[model samples]
Target chain A: MAGYQDLVLRVNLTTGKVATESLNKEWARDFLGGKGLGIKYLYEEVGPGVEALSPENKLIFMTGPFTGTIVPCSGKLGIITKSPLNGYILDCSIGGSAAVEIKRAGYDAVIVEGKSDYPVYLLIEDGQVELKEAGDYWGLCCHDTEEKLKKVYGDDYSVLSIGPAGENLVAYACITSDLYRQAGRGGVGAVMGSKMLKAVVVKGTGAVRAADAKKLMDVTYNAYKNDLLTDTNLWAYTDGTPMIVELSQTTGILPTRNFQQGTFDQFANIKSEAVAAAREAKKGCVSCGLGCGNFTRVGEAVVEGPEYETLSIAGSNCGINDLGAIVKFNANCDAFGLDTISAGGTIAFAMEMTEKGIYDFGIRFGDADKYVELPELIAKREGLGAELALGAKKLAEKYGGIEFAMQVKGLEFPGYDPRGAWGMGLAYATAPRGACHMSAWPVADEAYGEGNPFTIEGKAEMVKDLQHYNAAKFSLILCDFWALSFDIMAEMLSALLGEEVTAQSLEQAGERIFNLARLFNTREGLSAKDDVLPARIHRHPLATGSTEGKTLPEEEFIKMLLEYYSIRGWDNNGVPSGEKLQELGLR
Target chain B: MIIIELRGPLARYGCEHGEKGRIEAKADNGVTVRQILNQVPIPLQHVGLIVVNGKKGSLQTMLSEGDSVVIFPVVAGG
Candidate 1:
């Protein structure tokens, strides 16, 4: 407990009461922190088959030992909850100053349970907590809500709030934090909306201490000085993720026109140089040496990045590549508290659906002007937005075009086209929360000519390894861009916890965490059958591009699955085996 | 002449481009990406993605007549 506060705060909206509980030391040791600890508590508390957006389900916001510490890029909090969109366990880690604020608030995790009779917001400062009436703020957009809250509670306070999208229960509604950052994907915001919770405003003046402060400082500053400011990482440091616009474009994996194409012709207009032209300033999270977040101005409105995902989903995926307009779309999604990935994906699906006569509307693939109305409508669940609120999976099921739905396990795909990049295909099909790139972005080795993306030779094993690595990283609550090796993480953990830990031990815990997640999902009625790619991925061969005529053959998928299962010690159907459970100490 | 384009940071190594990422080089039949890159001033390690005629090609892949090549820096993501 040297590095940890060893405390978890629980708020019950039903009774309007608050309580603090001691952390389970053994479980904390085994699971590490952040998502691992959060899910462990979630599994024990929630029922075997509880409704995702019900009073019985709990929403957890957790931080790792490394969080709020001197470690570079350590400012991340893992949000874990039952997903209303996918009907599965969902974990989305939001980065920025908010996470470090949570850690400094002196709680390892915050759990919200039960439903309030009226709309409410939770305020936590130092060790004090309260539930306040949110009557006046219920209907405002995220931008307005943040502005209002910051004005009321000094500018020093960090706020995480949901907008109209969450208020109306848009399935993929996101929680906006640090103004522009989000705990997006799999409807984390909708679950909050279901509980009648509007926001969590936090401020902490307390300090986060490490066990060996001197050693930690030496290691931390060394990493900050040397590793972060490299020529290799210069692109990310300068242009942020939109730097990948050209990577996805030239590599022929940009998800364009609803994944009907892998390359966008107007890619240059949306790439980094174009985005940098509009960037007025840059910002970083607490303790971050390298800033990947840019404060970009698109005409009259100044907002944070419409990152690669936003650019692709709203711009190229819709067959519109106007950078300024994409930035506007990003700001709109942020204000409405919508997941740009799912929102843009859903919009594209609608566009394609309309093209196929499923519904007659002005929503077209290449029309950026008309799509402006869609985000507001979707947030309010009005007219065509009601059906679109079901996300691509359920919408495709109800209308038609199940084949073209850009979703897996009810969650929409990110910006990568599985048709062009096959590693992403396996990663998408098997991702715990559905098709998320953050699960394992092997594009470094897969699509960008570092390895054979077209082959299944060792992809299953590669994915298995990367998944375990990311699982551990998520548990540690580190940013994906931290790019720290396991050895450094082990050292950091060992120093913080005042214990001896090896890189191998951390990796083993990662494997254990993933298996437990599988066990949770299995009990939640998920199985290997649910781990599937949309038919469009298997049926529609790309007519042009680097991945021309490439489709994942059923046999290849089965073969890869079998190998993946073998590596994870799972059965033929992707269930973790008894021996595997025992080996990971989960039995 | 062989058509080659250097994008973003890689364009500094390229000379005389009317476009943002365009570069032109003397033609050689069945030239590989490595051969064309050897002639460019940028270090081979600094170069990451190499695309030939809209298709991803490696250092060993041979380029034919009328093929357009695009060279990019070592950045991969999203």
Candidate 2:
């Protein structure tokens, strides 16, 4: 454990136990860390048949060897647990000081198990751990709770906390970090809440020692320089992802009005220019070279993101085009600790339900002024928000509007309208995390020529390859944004770990994680049937947008799934076969 | 004559936002996005996305009048 401290901190809330364990080196080598290691621990500790929100579930927080190092965008952490929404393996990564602080606190990972008899929060400082009473903090939103913790602790302590949404166990609740960053999707926060843990406050002044500091710095600096020169990447860093509003709208892939159409004419209202114009300031993650996070000021309020997904789902998808409202919604999701994508998706489903006469509300598209009240109601799980909190899959199931749920595997689709870009649809269907856009963003190819997005010419190959690559990047705790190319990542890995990890090796590591996740899902009874997109994307053709009249044919989906499974060495039903498991050393 | 629109950083050198301006060129050798960039004296490589008529295209994509083109840089991460 030269690069790693070989330590994992374990907390049993029920018994008020705080202990440390040596790293399982064999598992470490095979699974790596972050997502890979987290999943390994989760699979071993929690049975698949256990209810996601039950006391039997465990939440594992992890950081990779590269985390806290000079590796660019290595400041990321993964919160792994069983998902209440998808009922499958859930691992969500987020940027902030949390992962770096955790690593510096002298542990590569932290596993919290069993429910506490009372509300509590974990505090860690240089390996010292404590379970503090959280009775006064239980019902507060994430922003207030974070502020209260910072006041009691210190501003330097990195905090991860949940809001009423998680405490209420809203299926799509997210864990909030560093004000606006989130380990969003799959109800990680709800799992945390179920354990009666309000937050994890961490402060660490320790440093991450690379095997070769000089090499690591040189490689990291080289990446920083390269990223500065990348055009699209520069845009992302400057305007944030919301800069894609115009592009997505123009392409008709913005997922408007809950996938009723892909394009929105009011996209200009939420474009990056509008957002940047409204911004009061900007910021980014710890040690991040590019400062991309936008903090906008409209009236007296401040907010983050409205990023592409939030703007699409909350704005165009719900027909609320006002940038101010979208920004406010994003901030609400952060303060209240909700996943903006899921929140937006759920709200959009409700709007569509209202439109179709299945349900009635005065809601209409582009009515940003009115939607402002929705998040507050949703966070408290009151009125229509209560039903919306059930998540799009459950809502659609209840309301007989399943065709327009715009979800896959029970998780709602993100901002990208899959109708225009077919690779994204495939990516969503096969993503281990369920309907996640980042698992593989093939739209970069189809939309911008990073690869061939439309042809499906090499899509099966591209999708499988990218999925593993993303998993590896996540494991290494690097931002998938800055790890744009494999060559750069291989250099970073080799430099930091003093190992010659080639692009092929990195891809192999990603494959290992992917298959391990599939095994977890299989053990949970998920099958090829669980891997699917909403009917709108596969059955009903869109009448407008760049992909007008184009729907991903079901046969193509089946073919792509088959190719993807085969590429990953999985069985015909998308489960990891025994030989494949052994190949990844997971067996 | 053909026109294209620049966005984000690339918009700094452009005449207008979403405005169309024609560049004279031969039919078969119609000015590519690259040639247009050369004439405009802007850094084309800084562009992360080039959409021609709402389809993801590149600088190698030839320009044509009546084509609503938008060139942008990368703007978001996971």
lDDT of each: 0.83, 0.80
Give lDDT tens digits, candidate 2, residues A1-587: 54576899999998999999999987877677889889888888888789988888889999898877776667889889988876789999878889999988999999998899999999999879999999999999898999999999889999999999899898888998898888888889899988989999998888777778898888778778876446556565667777777777766677888888878877777887788788777787887766678888776567766677788887888888677777777777787888888888888887888878887756666667667777777878998788878988887777688888888888889888776777888899988878998788888766654554445567778888778888887887777667467788788778777878788777888888888888888888988888888878778877786668878887887888788788777788888878887877777
Q: Candidate 1 lDDT, tens digit per residue, A247-318?
A: 788666788888898888888899888888999988877777667887889877667887889889888998
Model 2 residue A81 distance off true place after TM-score fit, in angstroms = 0.7
The docking category that best describes candidate 1 is acceptable
Candidate 1 collision pairs: none
fnat, candidate 2? Answer: 0.46
lDDT of 1 at A233: 53
Tell me the spans in candidate 1 whose CA falls farther than 4 Å from its real position.
B1-47, B52-54, B60-77
